[model samples]
Target chain A: MTAQALHQHQPHRPEDGHKLHGYPPGDLAIWVFILAELGAFFVLFTVYAFTRLKHLQLFAEMQRTLDSDAGMINTLLLITGSWCVARAVAAIKRNHCRASAHWLLAAIGSGVGFLIVKYFEYGAKFAAGINLDTNLFYTFYIALTAFHAMHVVLGMAILLLVWKKAMAGGYSAQDHHGMETGASYWHMVDLVWIILFPLVYVMR
Target chain B: MGVHFLNVIWVALMVATVLTWLIGKTGELSTAMVVAVLVISAVKGWLIIYDFMALRRVRLLWRGLVLGWLLLTLSIILLAYWLGIK
Candidate 1:
């Protein structure tokens, strides 16, 4: 309803509204979607947390089998990515388009690096003769993290577009809509990793 | 015995307690300590949504979307409890 109202008014109205110099309304809409995705991921995280509390002993045993070092390293990688993307947003705000592009590239690079590490982690689990059907804990781990990897892929795609736009000087301090929305999505991805780290890696 | 090092959350909390003790000897069970940590985590989340996303001061409706996440969390826990029941 709100979208239809905005759409009906947008064509008739000139492009002279309170849009930031370069931020696009379409991008802001995407950010709202990212927030919704975060909502879903948090629901998953919350369920896992509560379930783990019930099966504390089993979870503790499961934790002992899992690769904490890989989890920790991935956590660090994501934290680094979060910082870089936050910098990218700040650079966009300052109209430093080139710097924003650089940060976005680094953030995208981290997404790739995360997947590389994740591949190895999954390989290790497979080599241990484990599969998603191994147990409830393993099932949740694979399902949630696989879903998370999809978000990483999505985030990388968004960052790539933002980087291209940045390089073209397409986003002005006022019009950098994609930057804000992309940052929101990346932050959601990082937030999920944060919860997963402590729950799946740290807790016993 | 060495499993103490395996559960990283325990180690982290233990480190936090020791560090807090060094700073002020505010040992564990101090409401100040537990509340302090929880408050920090919540604020960290707020910063992720508000600053990183630049939604620092969005309108009430937009803000409500973020708040809705907490409600979702509660519902998820309830659902999990039902599922866990046998």
Candidate 2:
């Protein structure tokens, strides 16, 4: 579709003087979903924080056993992935489909890197016979990180689909809503990890 | 946003991540250290929400919702930390 045709389809608000202004980019449904997801995580994080207050010593000691280096690496990976996904959206907005696809692939690569690092980290814990029942700390640690890792998996899958579509010239500067939606989800995954790393591994 | 601008943001995020890691490595358990780490995290989260997520240019409601989420979550965690310290 031409840019003119795209603009016609979009609802014109008085505040939306420009195409990209007044409303959040991408589908409105995705933003609703993102807010719900963030709400869920907020509850989980709050629970973990207050619970730690009750058993500070156990939480701190267990935190020490965690590999902070691995956590740091994963944080970097997710941040890099977010950057690539952001670039992908930017490229698509400019009608650079090929570059957008390449950026999506790069984001997926970073996600894969994160999962691999997490796998080893989990492997070490399992080898040491750690399980959900180990203690309150390990339970929260395992549950929280595992939950976040699952989101990473889902985010990468979304990116892969976006990448496939981009490679097929399915997106253009005139309309790339799907690409923006996927990028938004990927960045939320990264944002969550930004807090998780410090709360679980670094913060005393 | 321009590609160059995105690159600059990426570089800033990287440097901040490294600083947080170094603080973790120091292993000095104090209230101040915790506050420092959480503050750094809030900044990182802000950049991701506004820049990478492209919410900076959107309506205030959207931007405020996400940023509000970040602030409230961090504040609750900080309160819990303070209680623990007490």
Candidate 3:
């Protein structure tokens, strides 16, 4: 479908206005889940910040041992993945199933790239005899990142399912709630990393 | 959002990511630098929440909830930094 055709089918009429204005793009259940996930991360982030206040020197010293370059690359990957997913959602809304599937595949590829980088990073740290019990800083570093990495894995799985559906022509302009739901979850993953990269890697 | 606008946001986000990376690489520990990094993070989070998450057209309550999460989280981090400097 052309852009003009897609615009004509948009659910923006007076009757649909209430629907668009009331909730977000995805399902209410997904939004609830997102809020719960964010709440958990909020607590973890707060604890890390306050804990750093008590051991500033320890955090500063241990942080130096980290590879900021890898963190930056992971940030880029997640950001790109997010953009691709957004593009996928946009494509599907225009009833372009093939294009949406391609975009989703690209997003999944970015997720794979992130995992590869994170794997090497973890390998290097373990090679240096560093473990969760290395110290307070290393403990937080490993725990926090490992937790976030788990979320990335889950996000990729969700994306994979969405891709399969998109490829099967399961979604269209009037019925893409699943795509938006998955996209929202993926964006949440990216959102957490946006804060995690700076709080854990950059901020001294 | 249009694909073109999303592309623009993607480029802007990449630039901001590189800037944050450069700032971290400088290895200068100062209050100003810390604030700069946190502020950059806040802006990035806002973009993801509002634009990428497609919350911009939603009700004010939902938008406020997500934005509030970002603001509150960053504020706590900033407060911690302030306490550290004390």
Superposition error at A62 for model 3 (Å) = 0.4
Go through the candidates in order and give the C-alpha RMSD of each one to the true structure. 9.4, 4.0, 5.5
The pairs that clash in candidate 3 are: none
In model 1, the clashing pairs are A20-A174, A20-A175, A21-A174, A21-A175, A22-A174, A22-A175, A22-A176, A23-A175, A23-A176, A23-A177
**What lDDT score goes with residue A171 in model 1?**
75
lDDT of 3 by residue, A1-204 (tens): 354432233332123533545667766677788999999999999999999989989999889889999999999999999999999988887788999999999999999999999999999999999999999999899999999999999999999999999999999888887888899999999999999999998988
Please write out the lDDT profile of model 1 over residues A1-204, one tens digit for every residue. Answer: 476542332110113433332222235566557667877788788878787767856766776776666766676666567667777766666677899899889888888989999999999999998899998899888998899999899988988988898999987666665576677778778766655654465434
Write down the RMSD of candidate 2 (Cα, Å).
4.0
Instruction: Identify the runs in model 3 with alpha carbons over 4 angstroms from their true place.
Output: A1-20
Spell out the clash pairs found in candidate 2: none
Q: Assess each model's interface with DockQ, reporting 2 decimals per model.
A: 0.14, 0.67, 0.71
Model 3 C-alpha RMSD to native: 5.5
Q: Write the per-residue lDDT of candidate 2 for residues B1-86, one digit (tens) a residue.
A: 77888999999999999999889888856889889988999999999988899887777888999999999999999999999999
TM-score on alpha carbons, each prediction? 0.72, 0.93, 0.93
Q: Please tell me which model should have the higher lDDT, number 1 or number 3.
A: 3
